[model samples]
Target: MLDELRNDPVILSYLQERANLTKGKIAEKLNIDTDIHTVCVHHFDYIDTLRMMMFYLFQQIGLNVVFYIPFNPNAPDVYKTWREIYERVSGCDYSRWECVESSQPNRGTKFAQYLDKCFPHQEDQLDNIRFLSFNHPTEFKEYLQKNPIVNNQNEVIASYEKDLNIYTDCTKSDHFYASRYGKFFLSLQNCKKTEDGIFLTYDDYVNMMTSGWVQYGSINGTQALTLLVDLRDYMDGVESFQNIMERLQSLVYLQEVSQVFDEVAKEQAGRHRLKCYLSNPFRCFPYVHQSRYQITVKQLIECTKDLARKVNRLLLAEREKKNVQLYLRELYKIYLTVKDKWEPSAKQKIEKLFSIHIPDHWEFAKEELYQLLTFYLGSTEEQENKILNFDQLIGKTLSAENIHVTGLSFKTFPWKTPELPSLLTHTWLKECIRCSFIATNQNIRINALLVDYYSRNVTRSTALYSIYHLLAYGNGQITFSYIKDLQENDGPSIYFMILEELYNKEKVNLEEQTEEFSWEETVTTQEEIPKEPLRNIPDLLWLDSDFCQRKFFLNAFVEHHPVYENDFHQQQAFSIIGKLLAEQGEGEELFRETMFPLFPQWTNAHKQNLLDTSYSSGLRTYK
Candidate 1:
């Protein structure tokens, strides 16, 4: 029958694929009636029919077979298969086969116990059962004690230590374990302690190999952090420095490991002790939290300095361009982490680090230095001194032709300092204005400095252009005293520039105030000021003090330009003057004395009436 079944293609394929046997092998095994004493069956989804058929064949041949079926009350098909197998095997002669029942519902432990019960008298048969089991820890402990790896206690301890040393060595050297032998050896080392000694069990070994740490022999910094975080969740308290370091060094880069150490030191209680341990590993100490691990401000600053030096060395080497940026950013982050812990003495070191220059990499380096300086030397005095020092340094290095102050804005340097303008050379000032004009957040300060630069070094076309550029874009409040000073010292060009601006502004305001008035229509009727330059104009006339100089400029303005002698221009000019004089409490005699010579066409009655009308609450008019 078996030979006939082998000729069937379905049976042949099932034997080859599922049972891992050829037709001839299956036939050979089927012919051996007495050789098969105890057959163990494990569940496989595809080979369920094959397994059942094989069990039925074995039962018909009066072979003792034990099927390890896991108890799943939720799975009715599994229970149905078990019942079928039980009925089929039990229906055979009861003397040749035996069915063992497990009292416990947990199928994990039941399989092993049921196997021992099925082959109680045959020690060799039980040994040859060769099945895997999942049992409780207590049951595994019982099995370990019954079957010890070593007969005595000393050998057990020796074996444990030997294996532990091997694991420690492998971890230290970052050695990859062998596929088969290493796994088996690790299993042996995963033994549980007993009253007599330590004993190995299949379940304990499996659990150890599957633990989060041992699952992956090697890990990186991020992975190590994940494992540490997981352990933090499971463990009750902080782990020891030795334990933490061993795991971290085995997994991550040495620098990353040091960073992790620093992180742990920040949160844990034994920071000083951990620091000492990391510094000198030869000294031995127990795993206890020591409260004396205080990190001083000076020590933190020195540590940050060391990191900065490392970054500097990388920069000096000019290799690892990618790592250079990354390390520089990280170094700055570390500085920020401990920035508040800076001592006064650490300023020199920080400044020294800041002074190191890397060509083409000066932007980020300057940014980091700016941040550090802002944090450490935050006082106004210290910042001033540092700015002066930087200015002197910059002045020495600044060239005549190529003045590329790209990153030197007000935020980067103290551009607003009064001394900065004096300390920097004229060439540097030009470059600073050019760079600061575009990059500064506070344009008012930059504009003020430009004005200062104009006052001192007015010869530079760049300074003049900077001042004019500021005025153009400065939102039209040209109220800086420097503008008046420019008018006094430089010439009337600034005065005319301001007057032109004010004229255009007043026209716009009048147009806005009176929507009925058209600017283009008014321009045709109003007299145009002649383009000839007006000379001998007093400087005080441009002053904004009490509108006195402005009124004076207006009077001088119409007198100098005869084309502006029309009634509209004269009335507008004299009306403003009358209002000013009335507000100043000047009598009509004074008004006549001040203005009749300026305006000879006006009668005394007309001038006094203009004055009286200007004093009225309503708008003043002239006939």
Candidate 2:
């Protein structure tokens, strides 16, 4: 990433003035201080800050930095993310630096046992830096694939706080041997609130899948344009399905292709779903297709016309009683020549359209052909649009006067393992468990990518000195605030435990909040439109009526809001249960009588609430 940035002309333009400057000249030009030394290191959460500091020291100021690192088993990603950030930063710019970590954690991790054997321990081993900073660190694996990963992170945040507070390689003192290491240990805390971890998390994914698209559509765009009357605009002079299909293909539409396949429901009151109709063609056709997406009207029309001609020839040959197989092969070849890979839906549709069979073994001869058709002719896809854009404000600590820090939520810290895609299990991702092999299908395999994307952040420093840098951006009047009972769909976490302990002091009168708190006092949020951003539900048994009923029950229960039932913690619990069911394929075959029993962990109240919802939603007479 750093390399890419350096290669970028814009970024290089930012650095060009200093590029030719010598070390002393660069220091003078950049106004960097050279006299900084005696750096003490804690967790390597933000390596960017460290790298930038080192660059100034070694490159401009010309001094080698000795880094004291710690290998915490519980926080290997701390090391891993450090390595990742180091690579990213140094790839563009870096300096000479060396690190000495716990030669042995002294306790009994596998790495520790190996190190303990390699070197002989002398008396007063704790005094040596090699044997220092090692503690009985917890394993990170204990937190993965929970009902949702955030639930697991609650424990992780609690565990890490303890690790920071009590444990060290040396004797526990008031300074805890702080000043002995560096004259000033930059005690940076993780407090700034963007989606935690460099890799995209669930919140980011959700943000991308909402409201609008990266680009809007024209022709068959928006809800108003979806009506049958609007189809004539693209049809131009001929009201043909082929004409409309040609105009719509590959072009972005605001309307989603209805998932419900009931043809009668599809033709509700004599038209397709009008919810996404392009209320104004002025906004749709020319602006969206011609201007926005850079797709001309002529291009869409020509593509569709070309596709129609091919299909008509096939139909004419069929009418003439010509060899249908030959035309079918040509059709398959035509599709293959244009498309990167053969799509199953394309194959199925073509076969069904011609009432012919396409053998899987047929390897159509390769040739270049302009594809005049698209798979999704009247559908909308999630065209990702950025929700938040932030500057790379990690380490430059020169600016001063006022600072306001935000996003101190648990969701943005301790780095919750992102919620895996539906119907994919953690066991499958980790060890390729075949007890229920998920990679058996493409949908499940694609979900595997989510795991890969998320797993990288496992070691990438999520909570770097971001908070420090944010505060340093404007030094004076530092202000940060977090709600005790935030409407984040969470309750008391380990952070709360720390607070409970703090408030337990005699000077403070606050007691441990063991009881349920009111939601109205916390935060208020409004209900928005339900978005089917995605679902990996197989087009298999879940499509069955009985199975659909069960799925409905599960989804309804997960999505149930008890009319102003605004308890965020309860919402979190509900959302978690929904994720567990989807990932584990639960409740799909359960009878109403046995459904509650299957979820033994769900409390009686939850079960009752679900029952109430089911009844109120007109799903009466549960067996």
Candidate 3:
């Protein structure tokens, strides 16, 4: 029979067209099936073969052919057609013929019989099935008061829906919703609303049947089943669906990019290749087709470009950080080489260190380098024996009174090098000055070095402002002289700015001391005073120089008065003026002159109270 079917041109063409198989392949498959006891026939491909001939051949070969028919007992036409097929195939061989019925109760009569047997006392079986099918747990329980049998078909469906809900409810279960729902719920939560309708996603029906939850059947011993179920409703617009899909795709792409970045960050070779790969837009758009991702081609391009830009920035910053560390390591090596010898060769190496161009992001490296150089320069005792002047050796002209160093001119000093200004900023200079001051025991040498360096650097104003507070730590005579020179050269405004900063720092120290000893007596004699000066006066007579002291008091009073608008600067100014007045014992005169003229609104009582408190042992009036 198989040979005849393969030779007939009409049958061969029909089989090829219907089964998508060649005549030779169909004949081969048929011959193979003949030796088997059971034969499987595709329900859809039944029409492609002569059914009677196939069945007769199966019987002749003592083989049984199985047909998985989707039975619908309620429809007469469907029932009649299947019955006719069965009768025609069975023929007159009643002895060999058989009919196997599915165990499921399909018809109402069969279902009634099942309910009667399983739940004999149940009267509302119909209502129970309806309630369970619609997921109305409340209605199902109410109907169960009269009792109902557990019908196989309805119970299987109810169990499936229950398990599905438990699985999709991410709050309860950790199942991968994307694998079950077609798309992740987190991405779906960002869905937009529109007027027409809320569009829905296409659920992965194939995954549902194969999911372990369904394949393992119900825990209650219910039969396993597979059915096309619409788990989610479509209430969003098409645009919303597309938007959600695009967002999901973007999230997936970003995760991939992050993984690549992490890998690149781990290896130098990977980082070198990152820039080239980052520039290519297609690298982030690996899954760009509509079938795999619903995003449009234009959107995919835009997203890739945005991701590439962001990733490139991250890579650039990473590279800059790495470069900064490398430069700092090189600078440290040069410092070590020149630590002991201050010879011409060592100076040439130091000159090369400063000659390299500094990138802005390497500000930390620049700071560290300046600190290292300052420490090394200050530590070496050979400078006095070298015969170079302080100016030539340090590349800055200083007052002879500031630092009397005797060192011969070192021709290899990097004074002639062009990148000196680029190597130093206001911050770097400040750090250098601090290191030098500490190393030299708050000597005028550091101040003079800074004064000379700032005179040559374009950032003199900023540099001066940064180190202004350091003057308070210097000797009284030198501080007074420096203030006098700054007032004369940079005008009274810059001088006043310096005074404000100095007094502000002093005020904070005074307040902290007061709080520490506030429990002591309200009044103590000047000599009995905690032996610690009320404040370490960097220049006791600096403020006693009537002209400078009076001018600063007046400026502070006018700017920080209560009637005047208050801000952080005003509060700071107020604290500075209060501390100076209380500590200097000159508040009585200043208030009578400066305070009275500024605000005449004060009464006699207010003036007397202010004077008494300012001259008291502690800052009673300020608090």
Candidate 4:
């Protein structure tokens, strides 16, 4: 066996590490006449198998041999395998020994019990045979009763110690243990204990090897961490080995556990986001009661960061290029919007790069919205309507202005005149028109065009006016006379329904009085104002307010009677005129001429009338 091991440097190294095994060292220790060769297998299973194999071989050759199971090896050993002992010893004819030794009782000790039960010999032969079980070796020695055979036993002790010391010496001086290779092997042994009290050995970890038990596949990793540490101690003076082991430890410890960690991190992030949302919830306000885009964005940001960190670690350890690129790309998209929202200073520079801005506030006028819409439209590909089906159309429209398209129709040629099957997609067109005309503040031509489109419906005009009323009021100007014209007219092109909802929902109290008044009494305030509906008077007058001036082209063609009247009267007149205008688009010469002069600036003063209790009471009653 020693000659067979001569060519294997690893085995030779293990052998040479043994101390007290020198031919001269053995003589100094034991002064024995016989030579003994010893081999060490760290595992108890292998040791037991090898011992049995040697027993048969030595016995067959008629060599006097003794076997001893030593104590306290480098690591805890596992139970022995029955097959290794059985197959190797089969040629020894165990049946002959069994018959001869059958009468002797078992050892009754757990470790040696098997030997006693399986190996029986004649009582006299058993008496001559020595059982050197170490469980109570001192007691067994005393039982020997001072037989001179003890002298030979002491020699065996010297022999065993000599072998162990020789192995130790070999380990100390062996270059393999002192080289970078030894340190590299040691590095794999770095691992921490699991919570369940299972000590994770650095090299033998099932999870690390298998990517979780390593099963039938090779997990290809370092040794148990503790074992590696032990190896490091063995190579203490070897600088190369020490460096290799430390580097390996660093690599293993640096591994990421992936996105699961990111989600755990979100608890901290959510608090910050909640604070921002709560500050002005309606603005940046969080929807505590339900999930919101802000929450999703936050999660995505965290995930991206975690993935980014992982890729960075990989780049450092393995230089995995593909992994680095994929993660970097994802990181950019995740940060694009979050940075804009969380860090406003970074927004301006990257604004054109991405449409990260949230939707505008409700107070945005149709004209401004239209311009924004146009800009957003230009950002995407200019495709024909077909490729962008109803869903895509709805999505783009809603995303652009927060308006939902709920209904559709094929084609409704011309506005105002009723057609079958609602030929045009009503909801889509309404939303688009609302976004363009109402939200963006398009000109009179667009307004006229909208009127033409919805010509079949008188209330559509009222709805249009109502949206304008809210915007005007929000700007600090209550179009009282316009409200009246809208009230008296058979539903003006602009209505106050939205204002009513806003007021009801918010419970805002407007001090202005609402009263019914004859057109004659109302018009006396501004004789030059349009004599149209009370609603028309405000549009007739305030149409030029900084807020209303932008979309003049939308309602410009609608003739205004340049005479001021009671707001209720004006509202009523415009409602009627709006109906007439909806049914009859662009051709009212008398009204057109009356409205001509009021063009640039049209609002009339009705402060005194607004203060009247009767007027206020009348307006409330009308609603």
Candidate 5:
């Protein structure tokens, strides 16, 4: 690559200009100019995945990321695939990144790589040199136990004396939200006993390997997170991974039985010390919740930063490229408006965090998030820069562009599924609860969930708004993709009808709703549709679960786990109740008993009319 570059006219001209400029500058600084010099970047190209791009941006961490997949010597690894690809594509031998037993890791200091920072070797810098490495969690934990480096610097004890490393922010002003996870691991080095006792539950596990514990983790939107875990996540009323994301909450203090150090949380000895070793935590964890506070300001900031990246991408697309300067100016104005509105209060809150200082520098991170917005606005200059992205600034002015929107499919895009579908129709399930039965966890919850999903807002204008606004981002021909026909018995998403309502119009003013959707017409049109149609598109799922591994694991666990005969009784309740409800028979008494709490005025008359055979079947389905 260097040989080819050296021969290129572009390189020659650039090098010659740099040489002449450097010579003149050096001559002026000194007495006379005798020799010419060449100037070029000492750093190599930092090739990395798109996932790592955003953080490299705000944190300004100078990391030359290289992708490496180590081979498993005993079994097949990525080494074989790369070798075959190289042989087939380029017909060359590929020998990089093979992990043979004899091939030892580079045990040199990581600071050794940074020439500008560590090369000159200022005596003060030499004493404080930190080597941060990105390594597997198992290897990192092993280094902490075995490596003789007791280099505890501030909040992190990075692996400086050897090959493994725990990543830390170079700038103290920016606190990597994930750093707290390392501290929790670091805290394990000390056995801090708690008299109050730790949270213990049935067959619990502190699920690390979460994106937060990962070093050089996936950069994809589906797997990345700015914050490792939210301690105050319990406050959320919604059903999210927070309900099951016990990354830290599951930590338990335990002592080994018979000195094996493999005892689970259930096993313990009287008057024994808490085991804080990594090796001890297969069945027992070392640390427990020390203190609780209604605090997660850092978390909030990190969440906001993540949201800002999303909003920034949208606005960048919306930018008027015909007048780039004016577009940036307008965006800056809006940014300033938000900053001005939120700044004073945010400053006070941050100041309060700084003033009330705690050990481990919990809130010691300086006010640096504002710089993110500053960087965002300043990035307009480097529109071609990957992080900033080319905001249509580099494209040909004469070229035609088309804006295409996809995933206009039903509930997939806007995702307006009822917030609490079980509550909507399963009010009757409370009777089973009164009889000491928990209906919420039963399979019958799906009867309401599925029904609520089908009859979900045909009136929701979000689909129209999103499509129009997203298209407004581009000054070009607009087109969209939609699932016009549902698979087999299913009909197209109800959103299709909602979108069609807008498409038939001559003009749409979102502020003006000309008329409400005619339910009679919608039902009449659906009369010829097949029965038991699918509501959602189905596919095999694994990695792309919106980074919620807990949900994925739990879902698969529930499906594959062996079921008792009695469990099937509750599971079949959904089909039975759904059949009776559509027939408008038998379950009127159940609804009266269960739903009276919600609507005490409702009576059997409501149910009889609801189930009336006189009504059209299609109309009854919508009802």
Candidate 6:
């Protein structure tokens, strides 16, 4: 029968012609077994392209085919034939049969009102023709046989109504009526009243399936319970079905939804289920896409944890690969630079060059130093940690001035260099002794030994000279005061006491010399002057001196000042000399500490002839 329908030109033509009309109405009256031979394709709108493909496949596979056209509006005497079919087959139900219209008028127009006010003019003409055509039974029979046309007497299904098998007694089971009656009840309630009739439509059928009406059997507890449980089970299945249906609906509405939502959902679900094992680039764990996950919530959490570990491992491997590549490039450059000149003996030289001796007090071992250097190299990452550890061990040790040496003898000093002569490298004759005084981190502790003699009324020059002599020969670290308590009973001698302890360790013989300076001992240069009584001295000076001797002691005092104060004194003294130089104006050479000529040359006449007198500026006196 399927082959017959496919090959039959008459049936194909009819099917093709009526394709535009709603298949529901056509299939309703047609005496056709829909399961055996399909006349109307279900969901054809969605699968038109698919159907075309299938049609070609069938053709390729040698199936008989024809293009169908059943309900052609331009057929000969279509209005007459349609009216006859509607009147007889539709059983005078004008609501069920649509009127044959020609040149439909717009609503609210005079022609539309006229057409709507009375019946269609085409309908009268159709009715007249229908009466004439079907008047003879022989002609109608011929029409049915020749046209493969369905006629009035054929047993057809009623599209609109279902017969309810009403149970007079409540015990009779009724599934269809229970399912459908609620829809009918609601439809009757919702429909607008019209003078002609009720338009009980297909939307009412859809409401029966979707609304909660079909959920219950009856008011009786037993039936209601059974019905509800079944409905619930059915609804659960229906919900899953609804998901698929909604996705399909989206395809129809794709133009409106932008298609991305469907793509995203599909991609998410697909990627989730796809399992993969990783391959290298690196010998690490597999990296999988998390979006394609389809596991349950608990499983998803576990999967995420696993994925994180895998991703971390992969990242580590990639980092190693990058490091290897970088190393390889560096190795190639090294090969280019040193390949020909490289020697096995060079290893010893390289090792020796890199070796360094850490200070005795410093606590780092060789391995520790290597680690420290490694940490320094890793300054790209753990810089703060490295710096913190380094600070903990050393913490600016060189920043101190009064560094008291304890273990090493003052006599055993580090290597002395002529290039950099310093009292620090000089060894005292005994164990730890007085060292040159410098700032202990710039926190001043005034040494009283330098000023003790001055306080006792010894000459300032003599005291200063002694202090300078001690500083130039001293060794080890010097200890001194950081604060001066002028109000203390110690009388500013505490700083000096600290120095005296260092001086005692140095084996210095501070025996006083009773003999005064002789002319030969005092005079070393042509410009030397004789010492005189030092008047206007506070109860501090123990000697008298001329300007030259006083100036020599002052210069010594400047050098013996604490190291930290050196910069300060230098700046202050320079400022004073600079002012003096500026007053003197431009000259042949600039003034400096040692090289510059001091005093102005003066030509003087005593009685008959003028003579040149040489005088020196006292700038070096404060050096």
**Looking at candidate 4, what is the lDDT of residue 471?**
28
Where does the lowest 10-residue lDDT sum fall in candidate 5? 382-391
Candidate 6 ranges beyond 4 A from true positions: 1-54, 71-623
Q: Tell me, by lDDT, which candidate is best.
A: 1
TM-score of each: 0.16, 0.23, 0.17, 0.16, 0.19, 0.12
In model 5, state the lDDT of residue 23.
Answer: 42
Measured with C-alpha atoms, the lDDT of residue 10 in candidate 2 is: 72
Query: In candidate 6, what are the lDDT values of residues 1-623, reduced to their tens digit?
Result: 57966877878887775454443444466654462233323111111222444443333444443332112233222222223222332235434534344443221122122212342233211110000112222332333344331212111111011111121111123222133222333442333223332222324323422332222122211222222222231122222222323322322232223233335456444543111111110101001121222222233223223322322321222112223333224323432333233333333322332343333343332234334433322212211111111111111122322122111112111111112134532123112224434444111112222122122232222222222222322232332221112113223233233334433333222223478775755655687545453332222122212334554354233221111123233233334444444335462134332212111111112100110122234433322
Please say which candidate is ahead in TM-score: 1 or 3. Answer: 3
What is residue 2's positional error in candidate 5, in angstroms?
33
- Those runs of model 2 whose alpha carbons end farther than 4 Å from true positions after fitting are 1-45, 48-220, 223-405, 416-493, 500-623
> Model 1, range 425-532, lDDT digits (tens) per residue?
645655665776664433433443343433333222222222222232222122211111211223223322342343232211111123566565544567887655
Of 2 and 3, which scores higher on TM-score? 2
lDDT of each: 0.33, 0.32, 0.32, 0.28, 0.29, 0.27
Q: Candidate 3 at residue 526, lDDT?
A: 67
Select the stronger candidate by TM-score from 1 and 4: 4
Q: Clashes in model 3: which pairs?
A: 197-236, 198-235, 198-236, 198-237, 199-236, 199-237, 387-407, 387-408, 388-407, 388-408
lDDT of 2 by residue, 1-623 (tens): 57866787777885775455455564566687884433344444433322443444453444444444333333433234444444443342223434344353332122222222333333211110110011112211111121111211111112123222232222123231122111101111011112221122222211211111111223211122222222333223322333244334522231111122222243443442121221211122222323233334444444434433433443332113334356456655644443333245434443443453534433221110111111212113331211111122232223323322222346544445445469865555545434335544433333333334433454214433233233223333433323233234643334323322322322122223488777666677898955563353323323433556755444334421111112333334333333333234344233324333323334557655654443121122112
Give candidate 6's whole-model lDDT. Answer: 0.27
Q: Candidate 1, after superposition: displacement of residue 248 in Å?
A: 17
The list of candidate 1 runs beyond 4 A from truth reads 1-50, 56-85, 88-623
Best by TM-score: 2
